[model samples]
Target: MLNKILLVCLLFSAGSSLTCKWMDRDFKQYSESALALLKTMKTNSTNSIDDIEVDDAVAFPNELYKHASKESREERLSFVAHVLDEIYALFEENQTRASWPENTVDDFLDIISQQANGVRRCAGKQTTNHHKKNHRKMSLYFKRLSRHVLEHMDYSADAWEFVREEVRIHLHKVHLLASS
Candidate 1:
């Protein structure tokens, strides 16, 4: 009788596992969504630079600065500088990431410059396909990213400006795509 009961228990566990395997499709869908973004980025890092989601890169800095700015000027500057360092470090990280192509400074600038006006124009053109509410959300997300950059970093010549511009525009494009 014990042997029969054990066999039944094992069978029940196996059936549950099989059921879970079937239910796992939802998890796979999210992963596939992420991969689709990766594929888009990889294929058009130059064109799609506008499409990469970069808000995650600046999120911590933005939140930290929001509170730190209430403190002394020194604390604010400290937070800002730290934010700059964190964003700057992302370039090296991208080197390891598969989707980002061989990005030159020029390619970065080309994509970044297309963002500010291009986004609003694209939305306007997409009026038939998109609604105003969704565009507003996309605008807000881009605003958050832009405000983060404006608060934390300065735009001067050299690698910093190139990278900053690229990041700003890329985040905006990503926001636009996400809302759609």
Candidate 2:
């Protein structure tokens, strides 16, 4: 009984964090039309350009949304912060892995919030100005994220190359998510 209760609590915690992630992403779009565009993104099987096309996107927002039904906002951020921790751990695995500066939950929150805000902004805007606002916001957020990533990037040549490749895969997915 104790083990079952612990498991339930763990699952509950996970659900909340994922919901927060969804909430953050959903809030980014401001306009109804923009949302329709976002909804059009295709679900993808691969996360790399070489494996797929840079322009090709399998937008799976539903899959992402379904995940939100389980968590509260704080739980969601904590969960994602944990995921970020793991990613960094992988990057810093090797003794020669170079400097992968530590990232806090706030860092993940900063990035997630920016991305979500962009999406929410797009969703809220009315379709009048040929999507310039949507594009501009996404571009700005993406650029900021790229900069943050660069700041924490590993300096070792081999490690650098690997993480760069890793980032490319993730960025592609982000592009798919920002389809609106």
Candidate 3:
């Protein structure tokens, strides 16, 4: 009886593992597309600093960033910085689009820029306590900025809730991986 129970548990675990992998397949595809779009935008922004694409290019990267290994944290950090750079550039172009004052946008951008610099500084180095701290700090900054943007960007309440959930998931992943 014990052997049968152990076999059932193992099978259940394997089944759930496969189910999760299957469910993640679609999300993974979406994330890949988002990363590609962000890369193109990053390249375009490099060529013409004034012309940043206005879409939510950073959306998919959150998924990828959540799953990235500790060894690749630097690259992920740079990826995040590039995403923020794009968003900040867009803010400069679309200041009139937001209902909020220019100062509000500037405040968020300033916070993002500081976090970006911290991430850049830690890039390509062995992970340390400082790197973890930087990630945590950046995660908090990102959540704040995301909430503000979602609210001001004309998204519906449901959309804002979706974004909030995404931010929660990403921050959870960041902290979880930081400990590991």
Per-candidate TM vs. native? Answer: 0.26, 0.25, 0.36
Model 1: residue 33 alpha-carbon error in angstroms = 33
The alpha-carbon deviation from the true structure for residue 145 of candidate 3, after best TM-score superposition, in angstroms, is 16
lDDT by residue (tens digit), candidate 3, 49-93: 223223453343444454444446454545444444544443444
Q: Candidate 2 — worst ten consecutive residues by lDDT sum?
A: 52-61
Error of 1 at 71 (Å): 1.3
Segments of candidate 2 deviating more than 4 angstroms? 1-70, 95-162, 165-180
Model 1 C-alpha lDDT per residue in residues 120-161, reported as the tens digit of each score:
322222332223333334345445544444333332122233
- Give each prediction's root-mean-square deviation over alpha carbons: 17.8, 17.2, 14.1
What's the TM for model 3? 0.36
Candidate 2 C-alpha RMSD relative to the actual structure:
17.2
Which regions of candidate 1 fall more than 4 Å away from where they truly are? 1-62, 96-180
Worst ten in a row by lDDT for model 1: 121-130
